[model samples]
Target chain A: MNVMIEATKLTKVYQMGDEQVHALRGVSFAVQKKDFIAIMGPSGSGKSTMLHIIGCLDRPTAGELFIEGLNVQEAGGNKLAEIRNQKIGFVFQNFNLMAKATAVENVELPLIYAGIRKRERRQRALAALERVGLSDRIKHRPPELSGGQRQRVAIARAMVTEPAFILADEPTGALDTTTSGQILDLFAELNDEGNTVILITHDPTVAQRTHRIIELLDGRITRDSSRNGVGA
Target chain B: MNILETMRSALWSLQSNKLRSFLSMLGIIIGVAAVVGIVSVGLGAQSSVLDMVSALGSNLIMISPASTVARGGSVSGDAVDLFTVDLANHMQETVHNMSLVVPQVQGSGLLIYEGANLRATLVGTTPSYPEVTNYHVQTGRFLHELDVENATPVVILGSRIAENLFGQANPIGRELTYVVGDRRHSLTIIGVMESKGQVLMGNYDSQVYVPISYAMERILRTQTVSTLMAQAISAEAASTAVGDAEFLLYSRLGTTDGFNVTSQDEMLETMGDVAFTLQLMLAAIGGISLVVGGIGVMNIMLVSVSERTREIGTRKALGAKRRDLLMQFIVESLALSTSGGAIGMILGVLIAKAVSDFGGWATSIEGPALAIAFTFSALVGLVAGVYPAMQAAKLDPVLALSHE
Candidate 1:
């Protein structure tokens, strides 16, 4: 399998007035294509920071990070944004669908950022929503959709760009257990269809649903292992 | 991103928040409207005043005895006769570019024509009076130098005088009898002057004009003419004509206090200066409102950026360039301001039209003024949108995403 992401000693430090807060400390990991993986951690474990770096939403303070063989650590904000548009899809915890935009419009966001033409963007967005089993909810706004359906639209949005990987940060954080199960099932289905998926969550149940789980603690990696015969 | 796509998205954003957009545009609307309306009104007033002053004649100038002071600066020059027929004749002969110089003597008389009696002004002027004042005879000949030389008892009746006395009958060759002082004099009517209703001086249409010789020698017997009407060759030559008249009058009278030479150009310039000042003051007032509107736009846009922090983060994570979010917010504000400006333009025009049609005020609405107002509001939008757009663009995506 082609390695989609490689991070060697990634570190993130933020200055909170007089003291520095180390969100990520010398974190290292690799994500292969079509990999169904979970980064499991508590609140201050820096999984979100690692996800941000992998998603190309931010650069590491001190480290070497590569996505699709390009050194993302050296990329500027605009370049990283372009890289993200071309390579990474992000699903947020809150569904993160623009409340005013229709489901199809929300799903079309990444493709829009990728500079796709209007007709093609719409067609692909429709197909992505269909793939997520949300074909009928395309016209519904976030407020009009159920929690599971809104997350489905967010997945469709993340899927529309055909990126190297889908990075979901606590994707089921706001949903109930049944909705969360449905969203995880959709993610598994997407992975089965040959899309790489990355999940950042603290829930052990969600972590066990993936093929591999990487646990982080105090901004450092604690464990990286694969479990056979899991739901991929 | 394509500009068209960005604009469409901006439009959608604004559409989703209708009330806030309109309330934000209110300041701009009122500002552009006030500016356009005031300028239209001022321009109309200026044009009307210019027209009224020009109706006398564009290159026309009037020479009158200046007001003089005695003791406490009270005007006491009513008894002074500062001008004579000779000075007028000299100016007419030697004045450069002077088309016509007509000396005039004013008097009041009672006319009796076939039992129709009316009290009217009697003007004694040279044959050149018609040329100087642009008063052309409608039906008959104007006063001639031969009639003046002969001191003939002939008169040119004003159109109103002819209309009142002869009804529809031709008054040329009709004998008109008039009482100048205590004696009744009969004169042959030669022509009727064209109707020039009421001018600044008085109603010329109700007067009668006779040769200077006949009016002065036979009627009022005045040798000193109080007023002189001079027509310059063109608007450009009026100053030269005035200079000539002033030089001659000053040389003869030996005192500048005796007479005043005033041109329509001078009156027009003075009135125009006053109008300009009024327009500038109005523009300042209008500009204040527009600035207030701009500030209002800035205030709302800043608030909008703050409220949409999460959305900005979403866009950023979705691979949107910082410029995308910046452009989105900026275009939204621009649309708000320009739309407000357009509506303000319409409102201003309506207000101006209402004032002119209903309030009986004059107002001129020019296309360029509307363009100016429209463009200015768009500029205000651009300037006002800058800070908010920068704030949005500068937002950290990680922090923004964390914003509830």
Candidate 2:
């Protein structure tokens, strides 16, 4: 199906020391193949909560989440894990590469869980790094790399599994303005290569780069807009 | 996904916290070392004990009157029945695995020659005593059957007793005076026993031998023998010989009163039992330390999990199963404990060897004890790692990612 991730009236309630915090309230959306989308919101806007459900990291309290035509809420913990392994690729803003692993080793993480053999995982990780234009920096750790290079390494890791959708959670949150721009450009380039890219961020500048932006405010979607031409 | 990659990842994590990991493993190290070392020491004690017991002879069975504590203890039957005279005949007729049986009556006397005076234990027995008890005559000749029948006034002195009396003078055919109760009698030294060596029991070189008839009728003035030493044809038949002797004694006396049969094997077994009990106690003590060490691993693992919240989140995002996270942490803990146990075993062996070489306490580490100690340590690790690993696995991927 072209509809890679479809959510319907998703609700999430979290207990925080005798108080109920409504993280998400009946949020509904769908992401299609090759579609570049942004869920843009400030802190406490439930954007992260939404990404967690779509990434199969959390199940909805009162809704249905269909990832790759499979309902995640009905899936067991192990099945959800398998679905996440097979279908999701998350790129975090911190460039969450393992601190001790080299760029190539960081990229190999997903395949390692996917039960890919070592030699092929190495080959695929090398190809993924090459795709991110990090062929020369594949042996460097995240601590040794510049912000933009680290983001590229994270992107390489996200793309290593060749998943249908790329979930970018505040992909430029930890970078300088110039490095953020470079990372945004890399996202647009990856989209140009026909990977569905979901950018979760608060910055208008980042949302302007996606073809569609679903803006949320206090656990509910306030705006859903589509600007079909690729870059801002 | 696979064990190799999991272990590699675990290895990497442990390597990152080398000092902390090593410190955490110290408990296991000490625990395993103590267990292995104590076990070796116990086994060594057992061996030394076996040496002391078997020095009397391995295939030899000693029949005494209950109360004398040997290396081990009696096997099954009760005690005490005079198998004295007809004992040898019954044994030869019934037990086919017999070799020799020497009845012994013990007495003590003061010996004097020139300016030297020595207190000596006198053993009265037949000519078969040396063969059954592994003693040999170094010089002159042993007493014969004719000497026992004739109540010969000849005596065979132990090496030390002969040396004390004779100095550089030849003791053979020399006149020696022995005082019994207040009466003194003169006897001729026919032979001197070879130096068998000294033990905790007594020095064999200080004993003097006389024929049973000569000792009981003249010196001891009694007919009751103190103990009997019997030799089986082979080591395998030693137990059978004890059993046969016990059966014959039971059938003859209808009770075990006045007779106790002890085998070298039984005595060795008792020593072995003592070693086993000691090892068990050591293991329990060691296990407590290992448990404490396991707790140390758990404590460190908990800190690691809390510290690596974002890392856990990233792995979950990259599709790590609960079992994967569980496996990773478990493997890390297991690696810590096993490595610690190995180092501890080496240290324990070294300590044991040092004690054996320099401290005079024998220590021996067998392969089985080492294996058991190591496996127990690893099991401790596994148990200790569970809660921490489960805690890490249960972390919320979104919240963990948000953690600094």
Candidate 3:
């Protein structure tokens, strides 16, 4: 199995006023290539912290994190940013699209940061939007699109960089049940196309569709399950 | 991200808030406009003044009687008669580098030609007046040395005086009556000088010139000359000529308090210094407004940073480096100020043109001034954008993404 992300004994402590809050306490996990996994937990369960650590958005207070065989804990800020740019794709619950930019422009954002040339960036963005079934709405701004369509545009933006893994935080949390199903179908399709997908959600119905599940409670993993007993 | 990408993003963001961007740019616009306009007009005035000084004859020097009262001496008639044609001649013979020497006396008189009466400034000077004062005869001939020795009733009319008195007719060879206090002397117009335009001293085209001997012996009946005008052989020799004249005058008069000698170059230098100081003071005042405009830019950038905190976080999460965010905001502010500077430069040129057209002032728009002002506005933008950009760059991504 090719491990795309591996977090070992990760702990994160944040200072709140004069008190210390442990957001994560000695959590360990690994995500394999092309694996569709859902991290499930209720609020304050440190699921978000786990997602952040996996996305390379925040450093752990004590742990070793490896992204594609590169130790993220030893990476500098800029190096970590490069890792995020080249390896991890992030999808927020709110879509996080620039409201003023068209769908294609938003899709091209990561490629711009990746220092790709303009013509190639546009070509790849169009391909990504086509992949997300947003080819017809490529010129539309986020505000002009429906919630599901907006999430599709966000997905296009995420996958446009051809990153190793797509890290989605509550991808369908803000959508209606019908729209949520369609977005989940798109994610499954993307995962089937050989892109690793990590979905963070509190809803079991949302987690049940994935191939594997990692459940957290009070900053510790309680269950790690695989539908096909490959590496569970 | 590359600079071009950053600039595009910055421009897109600014376009989303058009009114706010323009309002923020207004301060810089006014500041740069004021600076460009004031400096250009001030330079015009300085150049005009310098032109008038140069028109006075670059190689010329003047010797005049100093006020005896300034030396704590009682008024004496002998002191008023100290400067004479004999002393002028003696200085001409003794001073090195002397080219031409002309003594002059000045008064106001009424002229009558064919019932057209006008008051004109009368300059009683020797034949060398044309060479010493740079006056050229446009018609006929200038005053001859014979006219001075014989005290003949011959006079040269200025362009404006000739036009006023004789209309379209030639004034040369025409007789005109000059009225002094209780005396009316008829003089023949020997020449008409070309127009020399208005100068600091007065209108050169509105004066009449006569032989020094004629005015002293016949009209004013005064033996004293008001000033002794001398030309140096070259502009570079003017200082030497001044020193030699002053030495000769002091030796003959037995004291330095009675007369003052000044070269045209010295007067030009003093006036140039005064003009430079005035320009500096004006530019400083304009600079204050630029600083205020920079502060305004800083204030708006801070607001922009706060307003776009979530956007910054999103870009960071999408792999924008700290340097990228910094460049974006800095480029936005620079775009704002540089555009304002460009508009201000055009406005300043328009202002100078308006002044030259309507205010009757000579105004010039200097290229270097525009370049400097534009560069300064850009510098102001850079300085103003630093703190806000640093703040944006230092934002904690998680906290910023969660910000409302």
Candidate 4:
């Protein structure tokens, strides 16, 4: 099996004026190709900090993190940005779409940052939108779309660059139960199509649907469960 | 991201807030328009003044008695009476590069012909006055040397005076009464001068010309000449002619204290300096407005950056580097000011045209002024953008994303 993400003793400390706040303490995890994993934790459990570090949006105060065999800790600011552009895709709870950009334009964001040519970038963006079952909403802006449809557009944007894995931080947090089910079904279908996915959530029901679940408490992993007992 | 993509996104954001963008650009527009319009008007006035001077006469020099007070000397009647017809003739004969010399005596009087009466300036001069001063005879002939020798009581009516007194009838061979104080003399109008229009000195078409001999002996009863008009062989030789004439006058009068010699080119140069200074002052006033406009731009850009904090965070999360965000914001401000400059240039040209058309003022738009105005506006945009762009680029993505 190919390991897409490898972490060793990741620790994060933030300064609150003169005092220090520990967000993560010696958290260790590994995700393999095509694995659907959910990081479950209550509020203040440091799950958001872990998501930020894994998505390369930030660096841990002390840790070794590797994405697709490249050391994330050794990368400079611009280099980390490049790594994120090529290897990691992010889906935020708020959809995080440019309010003014249409669905197709929003999906084209990663490709633009990757310096892809315009014609090819557009073609790939259109294909990504179609893959998310949003072929008809290509010209609609985020404000004009429903909660489920906007989340679909954001998922399409994340997948447009063909990154190694999708890092979703509470992707269904803003949706109602029915819409959240539909989004989870889409994520399941994407994962089944051979894309590794990391989902962060606090709901036990949401964690149960994934192949593996890692629960954290007070910045430390309290449980790791795998149905097949592979890499557990 | 590429620069084109950055610029495209910048333009889209500006379009989303059209009213704010246009409001920010208004300052730059007014500043550039004022600069272009005022400088053009100043240049037009300068050229017109130079044209009027050329029309007065070219390759000409004027020598006159300086006021005793100007030289910080006590006034003396003998020194004031130093200019005479003989002295003019002697200087003309002795000075090199001089083509013609005419002595002049001037006085204002009322003329009466038939029942028409009008006030007019009377000039006493020689036959060479027309040639030296660029005035030509329309009909009949100018004063002859024989007239001066005989001190004949004859005069030439200017075109306006002729029309005023004779009412289209031939003024030549007619008689008009010249009255000064209590004395009145009957003079024959031998000729009428062509219209030379108004010049820097005064209206040439409102004066009457007579022989210098008659003007001194019969009219004002004075022996002194008021001015000496000397013409050089060519425009390039006027300076040499002025120097030689000044030296001759100094030697003859035994001092250079009483009289001053000046060339037309020197007068043009002085006028040019005054025009240049006026233009610089006007441009400085315009520049102040541009600085104020730049501050307005800075203020608006800061507001825009704060308003779009979430967008910046989204782009950063999407892998946009720090420089990318900086470039986008800077490009937005640059577009605003450059477009304003373009519009201002068009407005300025229209203003110049309107002034020339209805205000009776000459206005010329110069290319360099337009270029400088545009370049300065662009520079203003760049300077104004830096601080706001830095603020936007330095935002922490996590904090920005969480911001309301």
Q: Against the true structure, whose DockQ is highest?
A: 3
Tens digits of per-residue lDDT for model 3, B66-167: 766633575544435778999888878877688888899988989998768999999898888888888789998888989998989999999999988787
Clashing pairs in 3: none
TM-score of every model? Answer: 0.86, 0.81, 0.94, 0.92
Better by DockQ, candidate 4 or 1? 1
lDDT digits (tens) for residues B63-109 of candidate 1 = 88876666576556642565677767878889877887888888889
Write model 2 residue lDDT over A121-167, tens digit each, in one string: 99999999998899999889989999899999999999999987899
Ranking by TM-score: 3, 4, 1, 2
Residue pairs of candidate 2 with colliding backbone atoms = B79-B256, B80-B256, B80-B257, B80-B258, B80-B259, B81-B257, B81-B258, B81-B259
Task: Report residue B103 deviation for candidate 2 (angstroms).
Answer: 4.8
Which prediction has more favorable lDDT, 2 or 4?
Answer: 4
Q: Return whichever of 1 and 2 wins on lDDT.
A: 1
Model 1, A1-232: lDDT tens per residue?
3988888999999888999999999988888888999999999899888888888877889999888899887788899999888888889999888999999999888887788999999999999999999888889999999999988999999989898999999999999999899999999999999999999999999998999998999999898888984422
Q: Over the stretch B147-251, how does candidate 2's per-residue lDDT look in tens digits?
A: 989989889998988877786678899888888899787888899989886642578889899888889889988756777788889999988889988887778
Q: Best TM-score goes to which candidate?
A: 3
Q: Across the candidates, what are chain A's individual TM-scores?
A: 0.96, 0.95, 0.97, 0.98
Docking class of 2: medium
For model 4, the docking class works out as medium
DockQ, per-model, please? 0.73, 0.64, 0.75, 0.65
Residue ranges of candidate 1 with Cα displaced over 4 Å: A229-232, B68-80, B84-86, B104-127, B137-226, B233-237, B253-259, B264-277, B360-362
DockQ of 2: 0.64
Give the winner by DockQ: 2 or 4: 4
